[model samples]
Target: MKDVYLFSGFLGSGKTSMLTDVIRQLKEKNLKPAVIMNELGKLPFDSQAVEKDIPLKEMLEGCICCSGAEKTEAQIQSLLLDSDFDVLIIETTGAAHPVEALDAVYSPLFADKLNVKGIVTVADSKLWLHRETLTPQVRSLFMEQIRHAHLLLANKTDLLTEVEQGQVVYELQGLNPHAFILQTTNGRVPLHLLEGLKATTQADKADIVKAPIASLQLGSRLVEFTDVEFSQEQFEDWVRTLPETIYRMKGYVPIEGIKNPMLFQYAYGMVQWLPEYIKMPAKLVIIGENVGSLPVIGMN
Candidate 1:
């Protein structure tokens, strides 16, 4: 059976970064894993930043709830039938509903073969209080994400002080008392967070999980590291010539003597690049505002 790790979070809450870290750790331990990612538009960004050893299936053109349900199911089911991997990590769209994504995973023909070890909800601790009224659509989406989470990760803890972070966790815990509250800065977290958890599908209404309407956010600090080889000359040149609104940039670079390319990521001002110890070289993903270039990979 495949142990599935379902990841959900609001925009910029660091779900993508967290997923990449988790995969990196798995690869470091020599474990095989599969990944499925969803995005609202036609492109997939997170799917590109990760190491290439993992098989990635992208469900695009819709959020997980409506537009891409059946296709998502088919892709996951096929991954199960074909791959003998250690785990399945799924990153849902920033605007997605985690329960809906979980529902799709547990749909009729697939549940017996899969086990849901954990539900991770990454939230921006700083934004949860001040930006409570951001948007109705986003508000609803995040509510669903937090409500279904078994591990409420209050991400971006560095944005707040030690006490403020605790307060935030307290508030969130009150909302989802059953969930284990974990405070984080950028999504760097312990691997045990995903181990040995039990989940009953929504179809099993009596065992369903839901948090209160109250607000809270928590998560781990983001860790960026890489050993990918490349010319600092070209990378710096690319940055110097980059557009103004390039929010995040991550991909691979072919090293001078290495057979496999290196993995790299850039967010805000920080950049990270790592060598693929277990995976291969694949597509490059860059996300930005008014950032108009398409990723090299056409998977989405």
Candidate 2:
């Protein structure tokens, strides 16, 4: 069984930082690892953050849920056959849902090429408390990222007080009490945490209720707002109007103060934004559970 490690986290939660550091440490010990960085946008930062000694590739412009994960299998199969490295590290897009991402790797196509080393989720301790205010699709994305992980690297601990760190971990524990949680800054996770993991989640085929990306009841992304351009104020209106059932919201938006475009999500009435350090074309995907209504916008 080959070892495959996934780096999962919310947008700007330091997935790249952690990945880069991990690769560096592995190489320092003369361990070679292959990488697959998935993304919805053209530019993938994780691949570049890594040092040149490591072999890496970027899978962009799609989600793991691609028409039932067929594309994901194709990509992974290609990587497995082409790379000579001992381990595969998959860095999922911020838009990715970890369970769904796991499903992609566990597909029958590469079943022999991979065995989950462990799933590591990066949690931004500073922003978690305000996550609810992000868009529904965004919140669900974060919650889902943390849901099925066997090990979680609770990054950004420096931003919180000792007591507050406990609060964040407690809340995350509420989400996935079984997972081993580690605290760190800039996603400095120990390599041992990724050594062993097995995910038994049955492949999610349910249309609405068990969907991986949306809230169980909120019907997020049902209001699919993909590739649409919304200004800061317009984005704010959508935030104000989001329904409670919408657990996550995400995608790119053109914000006034941001130059390289920006990504934002709403969860628990908290709006979390990650400034794009590099300019990328704008795109968005919103998921809401059971709402069934496409977003209808009105200019004020």
Candidate 3:
């Protein structure tokens, strides 16, 4: 039977980074891994992180647990029939509920063919510290994700002070006494910690009630910048002017005087720019609450 692992986390919690690391480790061990990525936006930005050689299925424009559940089952069925992979990794949207995601994956048709591992959740330490600032619904969803995690990663610890880090660890431990919590930077975790794991048993799962789908309706907008090169300084200024409702933004941006587009990522008021050697499409996906009302570019 193939091993199946599910990744659960909020927006900009570094799920893709952790997924990439997991894929690399599995490949090094001579294991073939297939990926199923769900995105809230129309564009499949995160899917690009998976290599072409790896079998991949993408469910776009909805949460895998809700509207995409049927599509997800179909995709999984297709991958199982056509792919030669030994392990399956499913990464759900940031707004997805852990219980619902698991429900979609536990299809009776293929459940016996897989050995279900567990949910690996990445929690941003800084976000945990300021979670109260978020709307009650979003905060509840975030906590639910952490509460259901079998292995929780306190990610982005590098941005937290020692006291804050300790507080995050304490809070997470209190919320999930059964989980193995690890403090990490950039979602880095040793692969050995993830192996031979089992999902929450039937009795343990009985305790988790499904979250209200109505409360988790985060929005996303895909902005394409074709043949347009932005001034780096101007872009950063524009990002600063964005409202706090915008939680995560990521994609490639073409900068003036740069030969290739730079990978841009913004999360929780922090922006990171990494030089990309390859010429990726110049598009950005902004995810947040009512993000469609936000301007694609703040500067004229």
Candidate 4:
């Protein structure tokens, strides 16, 4: 049976960084690793992080838990048949709930062929501290991710003070006393600790499968800026005007005076822009509650 690991975390919580580290370690140990990456938009951004040689299946335009359940099962079957990998790592969309995602993976069609090792959740230290800023549904989703983790990583500890780190650990431990909590920087953790880790008991699995799948009430919009250029100041102003319900936005954008499109990312209230040497499609995927109805100019 192939070992399967599910990577769960909120947007910009460093799931990709942790996934890359895990892939590197697996390769060093001479294990072939495959990935199933789920994205909320038609265009995939994070799938690019997977190396060319790794067998990858991309699930786009919906979350695997609800809208893409059958597709997920089919993809898993395809990967098992077509790939020679010993390990399968599923990196779920940041907006996904852990229980729902797990249920989707436990489909009978492919469940017997695989062994689910565990769910590794990367929780952003700062985000936990400021979770009150999130909408009620999102905050509950974040807590559920931590509550169901077998190995909980308090990542981005470098951004927190000693006191803040303690608070994060204390709160996370309260939520999930059974999980092995590790304070990590840049999602770094020893791969040896992941061996034989199991997140859910059989009883827990039964409950998860039977539990009603809660709708996150989240929506997404793809904003294309094919030939548009925005001044840095103008973009910042627009970002500032965004409502609190708008949780995550990421993609490439054309910036004034830049030779190539810049990689833009926004989570919670933070905004980051990184220079990209190569030109990419200038489209941003905005994810949040009622994102499609958001009254924003130029985004439509």
Candidate 5:
């Protein structure tokens, strides 16, 4: 039987980074793993960051939980029938609800052949600790992701003091008492922590009550730029000035003074820039509530 792993996390919680490490470790163990990447934007960004050698299928322009349900089921069926991989990882968009994603995975087609190895949720320690500060709908979405997790990877623990880390874990335990919580820095979790985990069963699914998405007022805008370099400081200032509703934004940008083009990401009010060596057009997809009227250049 194939092992199916579903990774659920809020945006900027480092799901991709942890997934990269997980894939590398699985490769080291001679295990073939296929990945399904779900994105909310029409244009792809995270899919490009994944290693080329890995077998991948992307579900873009919608979340797997709702609009992309049919595609999610079809992709898994295709992978199951065509790929030789022994494991499948569905990396859902941060906006996804774990229960809905799992429901799609457990579609009648692959019931006997695949086992839900685990539903792993990676959470940002700081954000989760202060979830009350978030808008009601956004907070509901975030909590739903954590509600059904079998393993909670409390990532970005480096930003917390010892007492703070314990406090975070303690609070999460209150919400999910049975979940195994692991502290991680930069999502560097050990191989054993993720592999050989128990599969999520029907009873597990029944226990997780589905939350309504009516409250989530998410909107996305794709901004394209010509092959031009931006002033690094100016870009940073612009990113910082973005409204709080703009929760997540990521894409490639070329900074004027920087030696290399950079991959920029903004999540939880923090903007991060990583130098990119590749030659690609500058563009970004910004996701948030009430973001439709932002003064983004060349928006589509």
Candidate 6:
């Protein structure tokens, strides 16, 4: 049976960094491994940064737990048919719910061939301590990811003192007594901890208390503009002024003067922009709650 692993965590929880480590170590042991990186935005950074030698399948434009489910299943099936890897690692979008992600993986087509060896979740220590400060929907998303984890890595422990790390572990244990929790720095977990994970099945899962995912008002909007450039600083200022309800936003836009289309992302109150080569329509997918109207730099 082929082993399948799911790595889940919230945004900026270090899932990609950990996955990169696992892939490198697995290759050193002469094990063939493949990866699936799922993203909510069209522009993908994690997949592009991973070691190019390993086979990678990028699942983009939507969450694998929802709209991207069908595409995810098809891609995995395609991977299994083409090559027999020692393990298949699935890195879910930070916003995804673990149960839904597993449902996608356990689809009937590959049910007999693939065994879910484990579900590894990485938790941001600082975020966990201050979860109440987050919006209800964001907090729920973070907690739900921990609910069904077989292994929970309380990552970023270095940011806290020893006493604080212990408290975080204890609190998380209260939330999920079944999961084995380990603390790490920069997601530097030992490979042995990932081995021999008890294979889990649908029968093992408890009836999940459904979160108000629909009521959370999660949505996406596509905004388009005629090719034109605006002052980079002005564009960034507009991004910073977005309402707190806006959780994530990304797009490629043509700047008034810059030659290359600019790729930008706003998440966790942080905004970033970079030069991108993919020449698509100058459009942005704004994802948030009640994201009614946004500032446009150069529009027709």
RMSD of each: 19.1, 14.0, 17.3, 16.1, 16.9, 14.8
lDDT (Cα atoms) of all candidates against the true structure: 0.65, 0.66, 0.79, 0.78, 0.74, 0.74
- For model 5, residues 1-300, the per-residue Cα lDDT tens digits are 888888899999989888888888889999988999999998778888678777899998898978787798789889877878978889999999876676556543345467666678899999988899999999998987886677889999999889999999998888877578899977777778677465432211112212222212333344556655677787887777787867666667777776655787666677788887766546565555444456663222
Tell me how candidate 5 scores on lDDT: 0.74
Task: After superposing candidate 6 on the true structure, give the runs of residues whose Cα lies further than 4 Å from its correct spot.
Answer: 202-300
**TM-scores for all predictions:** 0.65, 0.63, 0.67, 0.67, 0.66, 0.67
Query: Relative to the unseen true structure, what is the C-alpha lDDT of residue 135 in candidate 6, on a scale of 0 to 100?
Result: 99
Worst 10 residues of 1 by lDDT: 216-225
Better of 1 and 2 by TM-score: 1
lDDT of 6 by residue, 1-300 (tens): 777889999999999889988887888888888998999898888897677777789988899978887798899988888866888999999999876676567543455467677679999998999999999999999998987677889999989988989999999999888778889877777777777566542210122212222212233344555535667787877777778866665566677677766877665588788887656556555555444443444532
Residue 129 in candidate 1, Cα distance off native in Å: 1.5
Clashes of each: 19, 39, 0, 0, 1, 4
Tens digit of per-residue lDDT, candidate 4, span 1-300: 888888999999999999899999999999999999999999989999899999999999999877886688889999988889999999999999876676566543344467777788999999999999999999999998998787899999999999999999998999888788999999987888787574221211111223221222333445556446898788889989999977666667788899987888776799999999987767665655445445543543
Best by lDDT: 3
Candidate 3 vs candidate 6, lDDT winner: 3
Question: After superposing candidate 1, which stretches have Cα over 4 Å from the reference?
Answer: 201-300
Clashing pairs in 6: 228-256, 229-255, 229-256, 230-256
